[model samples]
Each structure stands twice: as structure tokens, then as C-alpha cells.
Target: MSYFGGQPTNPFGAPTPKPPILKRQVPPLPENLDMATLADIRCSVNIFSPATGEIIEVVVGVEKRKFHVHDQILRSGSAFFKTALSKEWKEGKTRVVLLPDDAASLVDRYVQWLYTGKVGVTLDNGKTDYATLAGLYCLGEKLMHDAFQDRIVDALVSGTREPNNNAGHPTTCSFPMKDVVDDIYKGTPKGSPARRFMVDMHVMQGTSGWIDVERPESVNHEFAVDLAFAMMQERAVTGETKTKHAELNRGIPCSYHKHGKDGVCGGKA
Candidate 1:
């Protein structure tokens, strides 16, 4: 048979239609191409200039683990470091800063975030590592980095609201456990954004089973009081026990953010 399965012809003796054109596969560029020659290539912020500044040795945790970070980047990103690295401080003279109380792993994460605006944490069973994030928040608080703390809050909110890989893709928004709560409450002071966010989470999505009444230690005293007061205020205003979990979980992104008088919400101008 012909290529068209037979000699195909038009009834009016018109020209037969041409076959569809096949697209040619273009080969990828070679691995050793000169990247500098590419036009309009945006460059990242020059956070690392080894030749320009001195290196600060940060000794963290009881183990005395050391991280040699660029002084300029560290000072530029952290208020604590900026103050500590100043000429008036002993750390500045010694060129070494010590954080004996903070967790080394968390310090490592902070360092990673300092270098690249992102850091990764190990998840448990495909679930977000709330405890690790909580630790990072506490570390950020200690470091006096509002931007870092705000980022942690954002991570917490996004992680909780993410859909699980279950049959229904249900949202497994588990409130921070007792240890996490204790760590946060102990690390952060009253009215801290982390504390407020925890209180709000419990008020919206908490259940009786979330707290073990028999084990009083499982609940932080301040957290329990805050939860009760929040629940009462909600009931008084709305006149119902219905929880606004959905709204709290997915509402305004800046609801739990910490902003100054003129500072913008969600860290944007």
C-alpha cells in the first residue's frame, strides 16, 4: 500500500494536504560552556567576600563545636552578632563568640541560613519537624534576629497546613507537643510571637485529648492559662465553642508575625 494507505485524492482534483511536520530535538548545551558569556544572567547578592573581611569563630553548645563564619555576613544578618562583634565587646577582640547553651544542630542550621537564605531539617515519617523548627525559633530569639524568627513562624504555619499523603490528603495539623511547648515557653518570654502562635493553634484546633489531665507536667502552666483565657474570650465573643481552625490555619499569613510600628506585615515593605 502507499504511504497514505492508498492513493488518496480529492473529489475536486485539488492538491493533497501535506503531512504534519515533526519537531527536531535540540541538544542541550555542553557541560563546559563559559557561564560568564551568558547575557542577562542575574547574580546573587555578594554575601561571601573572603578577601574583604575577617572570619569569626563561633563556639556553640557544650561540645564546643566551632563554625568559622565570615564576619561581615554574620554581623549583617544578626543583631546579636553585630553587637557582639563590635569593638567594645570582648568577642570582637578575641575574634571568637561563644554560645554554650544553644544546641549545636540549631546553630548549624542558623549558619546555613546565614550563608544561603534557606536550610533543611530532617522530617519524621514525612511530617514536618516542628520540634526542630521550634528550636530554631528559640535560637533566633536568643540571637535577636527578628527576620529569622519570623521565617520560622512562617515555616511552622506552612508546615502544619501542608496536606498529608494519606488517602484523603488530609491536613495533619498537630499542635506542638509538650516538650516543644515547654522549650518554646521557656526559651521565649511572654507575648512572644512563638508563644502567641502556639496559644492560637491550641485554641483553634486543640481537643481534650491533646492535653493529658492526669499528667499536669505535660502542659505548660502559661500555655494552659493562655489557652483557657483565649477559649473563654472566643466563646464570650462568638457565643459558641466552634473552633475557627480553618481560618487560623489558612487565614492571614501575618497574623502571628512580629512587626515594628512602621514595619510591614509578613516581612514585606
Candidate 2:
């Protein structure tokens, strides 16, 4: 259901926009990643952003996240909801509330973010926390639930976010693709347009790309594979089946985004 009144519930799923995953040529590797042993990086969760009143089903990998543990991470992808909404994680000696809902089957993507600080998704999952929060800040961004979306945005923006990287591009297109992917996998609606103010910090690292992509995914696994390829591709040394390279730029082509994507990729603020 559209929680944003007339906005597309799942924009990425439709039309399946052409991804910016290019190498000055069409790639012939993405389709065969199935042989790469799709490692499971998902986690079942019930997340309540007290900030936005959003109750979410989080998919996380095996990472030690102190965000708001509603469930225990015994293994990977094996978890239970926190019973109720009051199971806010505390310091010590706090009671972890239990839930009575059947919120299972949400995993992998979230775990990707926990381990690598990034996530990605298709129509079959929930949006990662970071990307979902970014969408909320832009407002009008498509979302599974308005209140919940707002809460996630509120949490990250509410705090002091330390500099993660120098070339951290936060726009929908150049957006931490992996993070947005995580959110999409978890079923978070892509965002509408973003405001200049919001785009400045997140999109452009406090600079621009406010409106263009509602929910941005690389259109294919090429984005991620290409990225990983970039680092290792050149280092494969004699093509010994190890290391590759990636080709990522700020050209995913997303408009209709609110603030007009006023920044450059890699957060050029």
C-alpha cells in the first residue's frame, strides 16, 4: 500500500531503469554471479524507530549492532521480534521485550550493511537502515510507512554522524548504493525528491542531488561487482582468478527528485 498518498509504492521495481553500471561496454559477468555462492547476509528483525514511530522488519547479517537490539544475534538470519514496541535497547540490566508477531524471512541485505556499512535490494526485500534514513530526510520519498521512514531519518540526522569516508557520495544515484539497496531489499519505498538542505549533507555531503531518484539501485549487481572488481581487477596479477576492478561514477540518472540534484558524485561538499 502507498503510505505516501499517490506516490509509487515500489518505484524501482517498475520499468527497471537502466543502471549506470557500464565499463565503456556491456558486461558479461553479472548474470553469472549465481555461481559466486550468494552468501546469506540477511537477518530477521522488528525495528521501531522511536524517532519516527516506524515499526520495521530489519534484515541484518552477523554484525554487532548496538543500534536498538530487539533481537539477539545468535547465528545469522535466525532471530525473533522483540515482542513489543517497548523493547528499546539500553545500557545494562534492561528488560528485552519479546514480541508475539510472525515477522520472519527478512534477512541478508541488512547483514551486508552491518558488515560492510552498505546494502542493496530489489523488490523482494526491505530497505537498509542507512538508505531508508536518507530517503526520510528528503521527504516525499516513497516509503512503506511514513512514520517509520521519518523515524529512521530522524535517528541518523539527529545524531552527529562522523565522516565515514572522503569520497562518500550520498545522492540517490551516487548514494551509498549498497545502503539504499539494503533498504529496498527490506521493502522500504524509494524516496520522492529531496530538498536542497537535505541533499547538501547526505547527497552532496552537505551539498546536493535533492530530487532525481526516489529509490536508487544500480539496476543490476554490476554496480557492486564492478566496484569490487575495481579494487581487485587490476590486482588479479596474470589473471590467477583473484582480484578485480570496478567502474563507478555519478551517472545513475534519477530526476523527479525534489531538490534538483545540485551536487556532484562522491559528496563534493
Candidate 3:
């Protein structure tokens, strides 16, 4: 229950999504912080470091949870875009330490596991727990790499739009739907990078199962396929041409296209 203008109302209004409170292993600590750190985090850079070199290095400190770590320096070997983005504003090419707080949260999740040698993510009680869950999702993605993040995102976004269902995304998948939806609605438009960054959807499993990092290969593929298939099916069902997919299952065509050459239509037309 959240107090909106002094009135207690459902955090998730009509949809009544699974609450972040329910997922909490520890109740909201007024500001329960789970800190993280990254050290020598090196990723590949184009034309900056021999087509691959040091991208960022960071060390995080969380006053609570006794979580502290100095990760093995990170380095990338041949990559284009860099996600280790920073606002420090250096000359030409520079290292990015400490991702934004929200992004760093993910790094903490990974380091915490490596340090304690323990999987901290567990559904301890029947409260909508966002903090712990969010941390776990971030950690899992960080450690496991893009596959993990992609899997989680696909699962979370399943049924969120047309592509999800077409890809065989299951309804049982757990990804923070409510929080993400709230974040999207509450966040500023695309222009507002700050607000966009603040809107982290690492937690929101809606009417889905628990957000566990088990079986990534199966889960992600199934979800992606479901999303793709569902999207194609939706297009056909709606008699939409030229455009192979629709947005949000609302029969609205997207201006752009993606995926392999086949994509939504699969060149059947």
C-alpha cells in the first residue's frame, strides 16, 4: 500500500501487478541500499584502444548490507558501442568508471555473489520485494552477460507488446511489469535522459513466476520466439501489410524494421 496524496491506494492501479513490496527479502529499509563496485572493467573501444581496450573501472560502497568489493579490472576486446557511459566529460577517449547508480546496482549484484559466494536472491516473504529482486536481476545480467539481460528483458516484456507473444514468451515468465509500467508512465519522454536512466525496469514480474536466473537458454529463446511469432500472428490477424509487426499488440505499425532479413513477414509476402 502506497500513500498517494495521503490516500492509500494500490501501487499498481487497475492491472494489480505483483507488488515490489511482496518480493522484498528485507522490507524497504527506508532507503535500503545494496552497493556495488567495479574495478579494471575493460571493454573494447573503436579507434581508441587498438580496437579493444580499457573501457571503465569502478569501486562501489554501500553503507548497508556490509557489501563491499573491488572487482577484477574489466576489459573489452573489439566492440563498438560502450555501455559504460559516464557524464564525467573527458577529452576525446576516456575511461568510464562507475555506471550510473541504477546501472551500478547491477554490478553490485554480481560482485556480491562473487564475494560472499552466495546467491542473495531469495523470495523470503509474501511482500512485494523490489530491492532484492532488482539487485538479483541486475547481478544475474552482469555476470551472465547480455544473454541474461536479454532473457530477463524478453520475459519481462512478454505480453507487453506484440513481439513478445509471437516469440513464444510464456505467461508464467517473471519480469517486473508493474514497476516498469509505472516507470514508463512516470518517467519523462525520450528526450529526458536523466528520467529515462532513472526508470530502471530490472524488477517487475507481474502475474508471472519468480525471477530466478535458472535455465537462461530455454527461457530466453522461448520468450523471444513467442514474441516474434505472436507479433507476426497479430499482424496477419489484423490484416496489416507492408509492416510485418505491430506495437503493443495494438495493431499499430512501427516505422522501422529490425531482425534478420526475414523479420516479421519472413518474406512470405
Highest-scoring model, TM-score: 1
TM per candidate comes to 0.67, 0.21, 0.28
The candidate with the higher lDDT, 1 or 3, is 1
The candidate, 1 or 2, that scores higher on TM-score is 1
Q: For model 1, how does the per-residue alpha-carbon lDDT over 1-269 read when each residue is reduced to its tens digit?
A: 00000111222334334333334422222222223422212213332112126778889889998887767656654678889999999999999999999888888767656544555543746666789888998897887777777778877787667666653547555456777788899999989989988888878877888888998876789999998898888765342422544345556455456775456775554
Tell me the spans in candidate 3 whose CA falls farther than 4 Å from its real position: 1-73, 76-96, 103-106, 113-118, 126-144, 147-175, 181-232, 235-269
TM-score of 1: 0.67
RMSD score of candidate 1 (Å):
22.8
Scored by lDDT, the top model is: 1
Off by over 4 Å in 2: 1-145, 158-160, 165-175, 179-203, 206-269
Cα RMSD for candidate 3?
20.7
Candidate 3: residue 131 lDDT (0-100): 44
State the C-alpha lDDT per candidate: 0.66, 0.30, 0.31
